[model samples]
Target: MRLPLGLTAAAILFVLTMVGGAILDQLNENMHVRYRDASVALERLEHASERISGLLREAVLDRNVLLTVGYDNLNRTLDTTLNNLEGLAESFGLSREVNLLGLRRLELQDIERRCLKLMDEDRWGEARDLLFGEDFALSRKLYEIDTENLVSVLDDRLRREATRFATARQASLGVRGLALILLLTSGVLFSRRLTRELAEQKRLQRELTAARDELEDRVRERTRELEHANRQLASLSYMDGLTQVANRRRFDVAYPQEWDRAVRHGYPLALLMVDVDQFKAFNDHYGHQAGDQCLQAVARVLRDSARRSGDIVARYGGEEFAVVLPGLDTRAAVAVAEAMRWAVESMRREHCVSDCADVVTISIGVATRQPKPHQEPAELLAEADKALYRAKSAGRNRVMVWSGEDVSFYI
Candidate 1:
């Protein structure tokens, strides 16, 4: 069943308190075990040191013996004592305390050295006298010190373990009391709080779901509106306003794709740039409004003349237009240029500045090339512009094609 947060927290607190009590109890038991083990190790060390000291005392009392015999027995006893002390220190993890034990062991070592020195000098009586006298006394004193240190370590360990046990016991009691309080509080408040919170949560969940659904619907409507707006913007971006044909922006976008395709398929692509002759003079004679009408008419003719599906006709700017045709060679491009020139001439608009006749004629430049790697769009336009200049130089109302090899002026 569902429950309020406060009640849930109280129950969780109760469970955590019980778990913590169990952990603390286990820790206290481990501390007791360690204390017991340390005490046992200390007792063993004390007994071993006492036994070794008793042997040294017995050897010293027998002063009539040769120095070699006493030295050998004492050396063996010292070795055995050192091994036992090291083993005990390791088992108890008492490396720092072992340093003190090491100092005591050094006293036994000094006694052995003195015995060897007496033997080297061939002074057996003096060596026996030293062993029975100061050396034996030092050995007994070191043994007493070792026993005292072990007792002190054991006492300290016991105190620490006792303190730890007491602290854990107190903590366990406190935690148990808190757990009982938490459990009781949870039990008392569970029924009414659980019922109220569950109802509130359900109400909030329903409200949130309704709000989410409303937001989704609004988003869908906004998405549809944006899609329609994007289509209108795309159309306006690519189409000329006056002529309803492709604009220069659209031509620029399509030209690169066509050029790449031509190169891939080893086909020819052609460009035609057309300009109206004496258009400024015509505008000056008639007016800006009539000049616009003439431009619209020319735009219609260019659009209609682009019969191939791959042809693009665009209003480049005032009094200028461009056409792109794919899969067309130079000869075919020249024919298309001528057709466009004649179409513009057919309009028969009068212009007094015309050198050939009193007619509005278009000068056309055609450039055709099989697309190649590293060819740029500006190269094609430059060729077409050069050809257009040639057509104008040869008298307006004519078409010219760029020969890839020579820059000769042509008509």
Candidate 2:
């Protein structure tokens, strides 16, 4: 009776193990399908948004009447994409984000209608302004934020599901182990059957291990891809679209971090506020396109001249640049400022309508501080600005250093 009972228990446990393994495998497969689907939907939405923006730009700026067809097609594609995205978001329990995206879509449509009306009136400037204005940018930014939040929520749920799958796998393993112990105890009475069962169990175990390994590999690969995408998004957020360099947002973030580090380490930190001399006149005489090219050239020079690993070059605003030099005293900082000024002048980009010189020139204001725990980063920035003003007042195309009491020309 005991032998038969043990054999029966072993058989039942084996069956349970197999069922649990099958269920876990199915769950993992379903997770993979959902992950892939959500990723595809996001990529499609991003592509559609980019294409729509391009079409709008062409219609307004280039006055390309033919782009109306492209715009209509993109609108249709975007609608389909958004519908798919909303469905996926709802499925992932992200209904709130879906609603937010819907609201953002409506906002974007209202902005688009006004822009199109302006375009029809041949108010290209107003249309262009509206297309690139704060309202349009805010709407687009909100859309991106909503999508990111949706992805984040979905990712967190998938991680929880993965954990549950791991737990189920462990349960399956324990059931299999118990089955093997029962089979061993009953081997004498049912040696032949036990042998066959053991062999079958070994084969199934091998297959299960292989499946788990493959699933884990897939999950790891997906994680790496998501991480890479996040890194790219962060880079794009910090970079200037026009200059291809660090933007003011990046500058705002870095300054305080560097300042804190300088305060902690008892090291000097330098700030350079640089401006293009007579940039407005240059823009009026040479046109905005030329002005853009000139700024790009100047940015390139500033980026190149600040060769230290700790130096940060950023487009502070239109025709203005800022450089953060870590561990540089007033003397070293002034030298770097002078080098930057010379490099821009050497570019010799023609700015004929300037009172300063025949070619484009930059005025730089240098300020260095051994930051204290009580001091703010803005103090250094303000000093640099004052030095920059004095440089411009004295004459353009020179570097000035702030001495706390007065600003003096560096060269």
Candidate 3:
């Protein structure tokens, strides 16, 4: 009777183990299929974006096609991609991305039309400008952002799948252990140690549960940290790495917002275009590393000088920097520019190669315009830039204002 009971227990445990393994295998297969499908969809969308961009470049920049063939092909391919994305969105619950892509495709079509017309006219420069304009660049940026978001979403899903897989594995293992205990009980029902063994099994089960819970809690905490890191990384995109100030991208964003606000309030918007005097000579003299340090120091001075809540100092490309002074007239703006110039000069960073001054100095052009209807804020920036040129041409280390006057001398 004991032998028969032992055989029966072994048979039941073997069957349960096989069934658990089959279930786990099936779950794993389903998870893999879903992950692969999502990955493939994202890759296809990327392929579409790259292909369209390439065709647009070839048609516009190279003028490889004299006709509208490229445009036709681009439209067809984008339509197909849109259709595919619609299916994927329904299956993957990506409706938001699909809507955004639709809008992007519409904008791309308009841009392509304008570019192809220019190419047809044999005006290559205009074609290139239209193709590479802010609109086109913005569309590409949006697509890139969307692609990253899609990839992130897919990665999150994959992580969730991994967690589910692990949970399933733990549940199967627990069930197998319980089955084994049942088998042992059947074969050793009359043993005096049965109760003690069961008590030990209960303790082991408690430990396993605790370990799983702890592991899950740790994963949650790590996920939160990863999320915070991602946000910080995004913010860094708009920051100048060396000087720790706003970069050109941040400047672009701020410019439009401030311009609109000033326009609404009918206030004068002032812009200061600041240039480090003989910066290239300074770089040639001291090497790029020192040049970077000089830039950082100058940025600090500019930032300190314009500490108003509305003042924005951003590193415009290379050694150039810009300060936007909203609500200030040309005179007040000029005063701020003079302060910035003196602050930088006081740093006395040696620039023996500079023809302007032996110490580091800055040239500034201040322009102020009352925001008017149907007028662009860029006009103001252009005036400030022209004034900056005049400052440099006259002599470096001075503040000049562009007030619709001849800028032959420093004011």
Question: Each model's TM-score?
Answer: 0.46, 0.61, 0.61
Sort all candidates by lDDT, best to worst. Answer: 2, 3, 1
Local distance difference test, per candidate? 0.72, 0.83, 0.78
Task: Please say which candidate is ahead in TM-score: 1 or 2.
Answer: 2
Candidate 2 regions exceeding 4 Å error are 1-82, 85-216
RMSD of each: 39.8, 8.4, 9.3
lDDT per residue for candidate 1 within 152-250, as digits (tens), equals 876676677678767876776676556455545666555565456447747976996998799789869977986786688667657777778887668
> What is candidate 3's lDDT per residue for 202-268, written digit by digit as tens?
8977996998799789869977986786578557756777788887768988998999999899888
Check candidate 1 and list the clashing pairs: none
lDDT for each residue of candidate 2 in 1-411, tens digit (9 for 90 to 100):
455776787888888897889888887887868777877777677666766775676566555444546666776776787788777766568777767877887788788878878887888899889999999999999888877877788889888888989898998989888887787787676777767877887898799799889989988998899789768866876777778888776887898999999999999999999999999999999889988898889888889888788789998877889999999999999988998899889888888888889999999999998999999999999999999999999888999899877636567
Which candidate wins on lDDT? 2
Task: Give me the overall lDDT of model 2.
Answer: 0.83
